[model samples]
Target: MKKLQRIFIYTFLSLAAIVSIFPFLWMLVSITNKSVDVTQGRLLPGTHLIENMKTLFATVDIVPALINSAIIAIITTILTLLLASLAGYGFEIHRSRGKDIVFTILLLSMMIPFAAIMVPLYRMFGSISDTAPFIGIDSLGAVILPTATTAFFIFFFRQNTKMFPKDLVEAGRIDGLSEIGVFFRIYMPTMKTTYAAAAIISFMNSWNNYLWPLVILQSPEKRTIPLLISNLGSSYSPDYGVIMSAIVIATLPTALVFFLMQKHFVAGMMGSVKG
Candidate 1:
């Protein structure tokens, strides 16, 4: 009976693994095949890999779109890490009345769907376009600013911050470090794992964000990877091979970020749970 149970568990896990990986495998195979071949659901790799890549590059401004996405993702990640960490550290380290209430309100904001605020956000950006064109509509700043630091990130950091030792903050303060110095030199270094996890989440979110960028950006040159991919599929006769290639390219950065920081991310999440 035990042997049979073990066999069943292994079989279940094997099936789950296959199901999870099949789409990525199929996408990889699709990139090598022609559009008709892809539509026909061919599972084997084809000889059209270079042809598909060449066609994708020759036809689209993928490079600029990549640059735009990288810029937005990197900047948003940095801002998120800095701001969320600061807020989290303050919330956890400094004692104050009404702090919990404020934090509660911020967390509650997370429950409100972005769709509810989309119209107002659009109108606000539109109103400021003439005064702050750099951050207004049609700019990458417009995309980054709205998503730079979300409540979820703040809560993530705050939860993780609870596990941090308060004695270290006191030690730094006693050692003649200013508040800013304590944070920059002590808190930041001690919380490397949390930062790594937050960076991965923030970068991925910014890189893949579509709706805000799609609505705000007007110029073709301002398109991010998601927007560009949408356009790739919007054509009357879409090239599935090229689209698959584009998707593969688009997925690489976030995948790389996650894989690189995977260990730290797990540790940070575990710390949050322990806290």
Candidate 2:
């Protein structure tokens, strides 16, 4: 009976894993096949991989879109780590009246759906387009600004900060370090795993962000990877192979980022829970 139960568990886990991974497997296979072959549900790999890639690169503005995505994701990740860590450190370290109340409000704000404020955010950016073209609508700054830091990130950092040793801050202060110096030299280094986790999440969010960027950016050159992929499917006669190729390429960066920092991400999340 125990052997039968063990077999059942393993079989169930195997099925679940296959279900989760099938779409990605299909996508990779589709990229190597022609549009007709892909549409016909070919499960086997084909010889059209090079042809599809050549067409995708030769015809699409994938390179520019990739560059735009990289710029926004990188900048947003950096700003999020900086601002969220600072806020988290302060909330955890500084004792002040109504601090919990303020933090509560911030967390509640996350419950408000982005769709609810999309119009207002668009109008706000539109209102400033003429005065600040650099950060206005249709610009990369617009894409990065709204998502530079989120309530979830703040909450995440704050939770993780709870586990941090307060003695270090005191030690740094005793050593005559300023608040800024202590944060930069002591806090940042000690929280490397948390930062790594935050970075992975932030970068992935910014890279895959479509709605705000779609609404804000109108120019072709300003388009990011998601927007570019949307365009690939917009045509009346969409090429499945090319679309899959683009998707595979678009997926590579986030995949690479996650795998590279996977260890740190798990550790940081565990730290957050322990805190």
Predicted structure with the largest lDDT when compared to the true one: 2
**What is the per-residue lDDT of model 2 for residues 91-166, given as tens digits with 9 covering 90 to 100?**
8888476888899989998898999999999999999999999899999998889898788888888998888899
**Model 2: CA > 4 A from native:** 1-4, 267-274
RMSD of each: 1.8, 1.7
Query: Candidate 1 — what's its lDDT?
Result: 0.89
| TM-score, every prediction | 0.93, 0.94
Candidate 1 Cα misplacement greater than 4 A, ranges: 1-4, 267-274
lDDT of 1 by residue, 1-275 (tens): 99999999999999999999999999999999999999998999999999999998999899999999999999999999999899988887885768988988998888989989999999999999999999998988888888987888878888888778999999999999999999999999998878888887777788999999989999999999999999988889888999999999999987786688788666655644555
Top model number, TM-score: 2
